[model samples]
Target: MGAETNGNLEFLSKIPEIKFTKLFINGEFVDSVSGKTFETIDPRTGEVIAGVAEGDKEDVDLAVKAARHAFDHGPWPRLPGTARRKILLKFADLIDEHAEELAALESIDAGKLFGWGKAVEIPGTAENVRYYAGAADKIHGETLKMSSAHQGYTLREPIGVVGHIIPWNFPSTMFLLKVSPALAAGCTMVVKPAEQTPLNALYFAHLAKLAGIPDGVLNVITGYGTTAGAAISSHMDIDKISFTGSTEVGRLILQAAATSNLKAVTLELGGKSPLIIFDDADVDQAAELALLGNLFNKGEICVAASRVFVQEGIYDQLVKKLAEKAKTWTVGDPFDPKVDKEQYDKVLSYIEHGKREGATLLTGGKPCGAKGYFIEPTVFTDVKDNMMIAKDEIFGPVMSLMKFKTVEEAIQRANATRYGLAAGVLTKDINVANTVSRSIRAGTIWINTYFAFDKDAPFGGYKMSGFGRDLGAQGLEQYLQVKSVVTPIYNSPWL
Candidate 1:
């Protein structure tokens, strides 16, 4: 491999030893009930990294039983919030201590940039956990002024056993996004990571054990989404399910949860978000934001700003800069393959659609290198709002550029999609920023910045992007159920 690199991308070379591949249940790594195993492939080289245990309905049931017991009879749910906080802080420290190994595993397993994982994401994950750990000791419900002749106060209690179905795009990020908050709320869980990437989740379970998290408090199941994911969703014992994935699969989970014990559900689904660049914006900064917004993480993110609406005044200049950036955008994977071939093929098909649909190919509308699922960073101009390239959630490094005459028009065009996960606005006019940001139907609208996700701020989507928040105090609420108790005022209402 060469030492070539791109901005903020350090091409580190290291093959992490695959230590844990079995399903983690009841504080121990164990084989599946059926003794079935599936080969986990390294996307960089398309080679088998390890034969992970294939957890199915039986495995999920066992995990759920453990989680249920943990919640009902064990100490996790019954433990003081301060105690939970202490243990979770230890877990966060463990994560930080092993940052390098986890980053290497994540980069190889998910085809992510190694440097970003090590320097940015890994540390960010530990911080997120710490944030939640701090919040654990602060969970409390407020007193309610009742209308009746009674005094009332509420108790915010852990909902119960949770089923976390996380995606492959941001494996550890999504894991902590769900797990940290739930743990802070004193909830036990059964986790099913994306089959495409499950190594870190297992490692996390190991860390949990070392952190003094009790047996059956946190379990990780590794297998395909259909068998293991569905089992977790439909398990009668699970009190809630938090999922991050496609809207299509989110629908399935909703159905499964509804038909089971009617568990509470939180879904962070798909998006076809937009990034608007007005005429007054700096062309260079706008171009950088657009490229980074759509191309970061190989465009596998749900909130990728694939739709770029540039005001006609600076459209041409921004387009020129974007073209140059697209050309220089590094396309390489650690150890070997850098992207999932399944998504790689899908991204190529979208590129062809851009051509056939009459969108002008500005730069990078083709594959790169001789081997693996590597595609050039693609950008298209003269794109119509109704075109497939502009309308669909392609989930790739493909950007669709369109010209808009007015802020109203930009807002309307941006809100055209069924998805409303996130959007980006680039403008110097405060009025324009306020107007367009308020008018957009998306859950998050980034002004002058993109991908500004944080642990303190809540994150989720509107419309097809799904419901419920994943960060902040709001994130912890998703795993808690409120119970109100009232007492008649000194025998005034004895009748």
Candidate 2:
């Protein structure tokens, strides 16, 4: 197949050649125990970029051993909080130094927008590292005054080896989200990057070593989720598992952890989040936020506002502006080539589902170029609550618009879905914002903007979206085990 590079991709010449492509273990890059390898394709060009090691059960066991050793006896966990913080700061600086390479790797490996990869994902990842570095020494425990007979306190200790099963959509961001906090919490981890996008994780392993993290502190395994992921979830030696993926896979991981060591687990799963635009809001601003809410990252986001509710008073004007904005989007070649065929087909299928379910096609409904995986940015109007496109989590650039009469109706319709990951409300009325935000059952509620993520904000979902927060102080708790300590002020009679 012939691949078309977007606008000649002059920047591609600046990307350094990729070198490392193997399972990272014990501060070294090595092949799988079975001596097997698999091809990692560039989603943009749909061509083989490199042959990555195919890690299996044997590889997972070895990684777990490395992590277990690090947690139990290695220098990383034993290091002073200040020392750990210094090393993590160095790691973040190194990432900043190599931001271009990491961004290029992510763009090539995952079909992320080139500008977004270079300007947003890479810098944001480093920010996460730096933010958590500041928290390394701040993992505080409580000093309590109990009954006078005893002095009682608590300790927040590391939970030992952790398994991080990363997702493909936001590879670098997701990696940092799990790894940074775990590192800050003094936990060693075995990371299984998604097979579809393993390049950046391996690159990061090299950076971690350069930043002076000890051997076995971080191990990355690349392979099919069934073999390597299963081993990690069920590994008896691993103390906890942090996963970001679909609800189906999250359930399987929960079961595996339950049946094996009953290890601690935190999941960031699927979502069908909603965005509500009231009549009182600025129509133009609402249209812009609505577009960003649904189409950012090609709508592959877990918290994407795929279900949009516009107040009936301004529904027609908002839909018109949204459609016009959708048409203006440059819909080809995310990095240099287009999106991968798999995702392209998936988005197209959802567009077709919208048509079949009686949703009016607003502006776009077709693929872009003939050469690469490019789908036109799509919008739909007159969507009903029960439509498949309205309810299902279509992780693509397709927006479903529906009309609502009142704020109560919007809140009720938004909360009707099984998911509760995130929601956005656009309104000038402070009461409307407060009331609707309070009523909507979502982990995060955006008052006027959309997709505003910060290191200090805790992010997660209720209902089927998943449990456990991923950022902020709550995120660090995921890798920590709380223990109460009690000591007598004087010698007891029994003693």
Candidate 3:
């Protein structure tokens, strides 16, 4: 529901409509080289929210040139660690100050609930900035033990100009994830956000300027992947490319990068994660978590537990209870304060596909309404591990519940898919938890709780889900290069 513009809430609700035309380049707003622009439509209302700059190869070259210049000869990379940290801290504070406006833009543009955008995504972005800001001052080199008559050490230095391409599902958060660490590591970057959700990113560039970030240190370009994205990936000036999107696109980026400088790449791609529920687990709690795991963010998340592997002993009971609970989840306008219409029609379409694909939908295989993208939260029972619904990464609010006889079968079925982003297990037995957790090949595993995260935890995947982490110290290391410094104490006799 849109907030009221009266009484105590007037100031909070009086967000002015933003009209963005030009992209942010070299610390200023400028149009594309071709003078091209595209309309960013709101998924909820199917209305053109704003016309964004349509950047192509030439624009990408300009942005990358600026960023490369900044990284090679500008003060951004040469700044002391404390100075960089101070600037990042100020950026985070500015984000906090404009939290409401950013959240509103994200909610309207991305079809996410305003409450979630305000309460979780915006604050999380600020925390990520602050986290990396603090980490900026702590990056250091190590002294090595030398066997020869030479002083040996190592340097962890910035990888130079980086190209960051973010996804649409979590625009603000992913922007911070890719940009914060790169900036903190002293690598100037040119960011290409998903065309579906480009507004928040442009707004972020505005905030960076407000925080006193230097020109060419951070830039935002808006355009399709074929043109703008290809140029950024294939640019010789870029030293590294950090992308968060589908696996298919990541492969293209890798190929393009290879064609040029073979830049270091960090990709956080797709997943068809699993949630296993054992016989001894709390059935009610497990069912609730199952629903939440698949329904959170309208199941638009990359690590959403699309497949649920339940033990045979309690499979039927859990399925029935989960179906009843799924019915209670309201689907309506995302702006509606009382409803959770986040995924709506997009989710419903997946539900229809499940039925048409002969997945034997046990419950919730229909649309909740004719208006909005509202799909009934659906679950399938007679699902096999090899089914399309189970194997594919359906980015919607649908879960395929399958049964397994033992832990070995569960693990076999869970790891059968190429994805290994995240998995959840529900069991009271510590040994069982430990065994199952170690056996499942996901990047992150939960014992009883599902969809949990920490800023310090390393998150990524094995297999086709893609690699490289997004948070923690390990995440920061992805943007850095390790250089070994060697100097001889005395001239070699051979020389």
- Model 3 lDDT per residue over 1-495, tens place: 444434326533634488565788888899999998998766655667788899999888889888988888899888888999999999999998988788888876787777677788799999999999998888899998887777889999999999999988888999998899899999999999988788999989998988888999999999999999998999988899999888899899989988888789988889999999999988899899999999888778988888999999999899889978888887765556111244454456566666777788877767655544546677888887777788888787789988899989988888888888999999999998999899988899988998789889998988888888989999899999999999987775633
**Candidates 1 and 3 compared by TM-score, better number:** 1
TM-score of each: 0.96, 0.96, 0.94
**Residue 180 accuracy (lDDT) in model 3:** 93
Cα lDDT tens digits, model 1, 1-495, are 244453224433366789999999999999999999997767776777889999999999999999999899999988888999999999999999999899999977887777778888888999989999998888888898887788899999999999999999899999998999999999999999999899999999999999999999999999999999999999899999999999999999999999988999999999999999999998989999999998988888999999999999998888889878887887776533235678878889999998998999999878876666778888999999889998888888889999999988998889899999999999899999999999999888899999998777899999999999989889999999999989878767553
Q: State in Å the error of residue 236, model 3.
A: 1.0
For all candidates in order, the CA lDDT equals 0.89, 0.88, 0.85
Candidate 1's clash total is: 2
Return the candidate ranking by lDDT, descending. Answer: 1, 2, 3
Clashing pairs in 1: 44-336, 44-337
Q: Highest lDDT: which candidate? A: 1
RMSD of each: 2.6, 2.5, 3.1
